[model samples]
Target: MRASHAYFLFVGTLLTAAGYGATFLLTEHFRALGGSEIDTSTTLGGAMAGTLIGVPLVGWYAKKLKAARMGAMGAVSVAAGYGFLALLTTLTPLIALAGFLIGLGWGIFYLAGPMALSERVTDQDRGFWFTRFGAFQMAGIGFSPIVAAALVEHLGLSTRGAFGVIAGATLVAAVLLLTFEALSPQASQARAQTSNWMRALPALLSSRAIYPILMVGLGACVFSGMLTFQSSLVRGTGLEAGTFFAAYAVTVVVARFVLAPMINRADGDRASVVLLALMILGVVTAFGLVYGVPVQIASAILLGLGYGLVYTVIQTQAVNDAPPEHRSAALTWFVIAYFFGIFGFPVLGGWLIVTVGIAGFLAAVLAFAVAEMALALLRGRQTTRKPVSA
Candidate 1:
């Protein structure tokens, strides 16, 4: 790997920490600012809207912007987003603006990081690097809440002060990413013959590509709801949000690091079913949180395994399985659905919290998980595309 690319991986790891560390504070911060439950959740919804806006723009300009420039911009956007959040003292619509920038930055990284990694390495090596990317992301995120707990719990830092730390971390990523050298001639030329990304939408919808989108949507919804309702779900269980997030991040890193090779080598369609099944188990275990902490811990383990593997396998399929020229376009579609889950579902979940109660929420989760599993199985049977083992 090139030195610049290696640095990209290192920076990517910190970038994850930067975005996520700030996030663990947002719900509580917003609530402290007098936000109702629905209002607090809307902050994430705004971020998802930013994602919704950013993905297509990234798709259109991906090759033109090149990876290095995008990385710099993305990192800056992250810092700015957090900076704004840190400065805010009370509830206002401006929280949405800050969330948008955060999502925009992440959205850019989601496209540019993969674009750069895949272009730099050979096809056989893509999966390995992507696996490391996931692991590093988990490590950074895992480490953050601990640090956050120290700053807030022990050091007496205000919530806003905590966000400053997040901003600094992302700025570090920006500086490192800016040092990357320009792409070589071969990469530049291949990127020049760009596909009209919009033209392929109809085809992607009808094909197997849609299945991963649907299945990942399930995972995204589960993740968003878990975080959005952290207080309510674990109210009687005596587990803090930090504990839950720490367990999740640790489990994901361990599972992904140990099992990367097996997952990367598996068929996308079939692998998705297994991943979805694991997610189903995780969701079931998660709903058991009302029962207590042991179930929550078990749920975290299952979720870490399931979510980590699903993204690696399913995303590889989205980008790698596509015709070379169309990879960015394919990723755009996946991202659209990914954010939709983040943006759309939480609002619905928020309503359930206000009205339908725990039973209603559990029922919704069950219905979604079952549907996700069925789609995964059906896709495994129906997909005609030959699987590629990296």
Candidate 2:
């Protein structure tokens, strides 16, 4: 790998840590401020709303801007958002604004980081590189809680103070990104000539990339539903939420790191179908069968093996399937669809968990998993019939 690639991976890890760390603490921070559940949801919703706006807006202008510059801007936005949260003493509308900044920043970074990296590798090595990058990202998310705990427990910092620390770290990421951009002036200018977003939209929506996009979106829903409500899912089962999460995280990192080459070499459509089936099995084992700690751990491992691997597979397809000039647009829409499911599904999941109980939520998750698998099969058959081109 190049020095630029190494730097991008390091900076990407730090950015993911900052974003997810702050998010992990949001609930506790709001509750500490005497905020109600509604206030907490509102704050989170604000972040989601901001992300929905930030992604497409950034994509629309992606060709005109360098990816590194966009990433820098995103880091600064996240810093500003966390900075605002650190200063807050009361649960107010301003909290929502802060959440919005964080979400918007994350949205831009999320899209720009992968978009930028995708350009750095060839189709032959894309899956390998992406899985490695994704492993780093997952490590960041998995370890963020430990980092937060250290800040509060070992360092004697308050929750608000932790937010400040994260903000400072994010700002450092911004500085590093900008410095890298400055040092590589020519590379930044080497991107394809600017193109209109309207012209690229059709390409992303075409048959070549559309199925991967849809499958990813559905896959996101499966991921969010299972992990986001894990606490609820484990209730009364005598299992700590950490048990499932830790097992899942370890499995994901191991799978991505050790299996990247194999995954990259596999048939995309067939692999997706098998992985999606694993996800379905995970949900069934966790929610459908008798509740037990062993069963929960098994479920986590299944999901880790399934979703962890499938994500990079389909994401790579989305880019490779699109025309070279429009690959960025393809990735942008892929990210948008992903976040939409990540943030949007929880609302429905929550409703189902409340109105019809966990069974309803489980049913919904199974439905999505089945649908995604079906889509993967279809995508495979389509690919077999006629190869797509850039």
Candidate 3:
């Protein structure tokens, strides 16, 4: 990889680690502050709410600003949020504000980083680069708990202190992003010519990009449901709570790194079908089969291979399908759809688990997986009949 690409990936990895590290520790931090369960949930909800608001806002501005600069601004917001989080002692609206800042920052970075990278690379190499970027992202998420543990256990820092450290790291990321923008070629900074997104919405939604957006949303539902409730699902299955996570993380990193070229070379539509099927099999193995460690691990591997590879494929498709001028908008909608499922489905999953037990939750997840598979098939057929515009 070029130095610029490598630097961009490193920055992405660092930002993700700082952002997700704080997120993983949020509950513990709130509880440490003597906050109630409701406070914790509400605070987290604030973050999700902020992300829902941020995605579109960033998308709108993406056309006007350099993606790297927007990402830097996002990092600043995240740092500010974390800095606020470090100083809080009581539950207040400030807590929500902090969460919102963090979420909004992440929302911007999520869209901006990919947008920037996509613009920098060619279509032929886009899938490989995206897969690598995603691998780094997963690595960040997977290793954050370890970093937090080191800080708290070895460094003798409190959870709040860790937030302070994370805040510093995020600021560093912001600086690096600015440096990246300075060193790279300047992209258009002119304002968008369109009056507004609402006027262009009909044409944008009518494109083949919708298929990947829908697939991503559905895929997020399955991914979140499985990960969020893995512990609950395995409560009595003689499995460790971290089993799925560890296995899944390792599998994703390996699959994305090792299989990216194959994915790049494969036919997009057929690959999506097969990959989505693997995800369904993973879900079935985890929830439907007799609960055991081997089965659980197998399920994790399947999910890792499936979702890990397919995400890059479909995301590339989402960009590839759009008109050049609308690529950012397409990606904007794609990220929004993903966050909606990531934040929205867990609430529904929690309700189902509470109302009708784990069976109900598993059934709902399966339905999503099936629906996603059906959509992949539909998209494949549609593409065959009418190839997506270049």
Which number leads on lDDT?
Answer: 3
In order, the Cα lDDT scores of the candidates are: 0.70, 0.73, 0.74
Query: What's the candidate order when arranged by decreasing TM-score?
Result: 1, 2, 3
Residue 67 displacement (Å), model 2: 1.5
lDDT of 1 by residue, 1-390 (tens): 564557555665566455754565565676677775576567767778877776666666766776656766777888888899899988888888888888888777766666666666666676677777667766776567667657888999887888888888888887766655342322543452245668887767766677776777876787666655665567656777666777888888888888768776676777777777787788788777766677777877777777767776777666654666566567777777777775567678767877888668767876777887787777767666455465
> Model 1 — which ten-residue stretch has the worst lDDT?
181-190
How well does each candidate superpose onto the true structure, as a TM-score?
Answer: 0.90, 0.84, 0.83
**Candidate 3 pairs with clashing backbones:** none
Q: Model 2, 1-390: lDDT tens per residue?
A: 476645654565566455654565565566678853345456666777878887876666656677767877888888899899999988789888997898888888787666566556566776556666677777666556556656877899887898888888888888776675565443533463334545678767775788888888888888877776675676666776557667787888899888766766777777777788898899888774345778888998999999988888888789778888887677777887887777667657766776788888899988988988888887777776332221
Q: Write the per-residue lDDT of candidate 3 for residues 181-268, one digit (tens) a residue.
A: 6776444543422224445556668988888999999998998778756656876667754567678878988987888677767788
Candidate with the larger TM-score of 2 and 3: 2
Backbone clashes, each candidate: 0, 0, 0
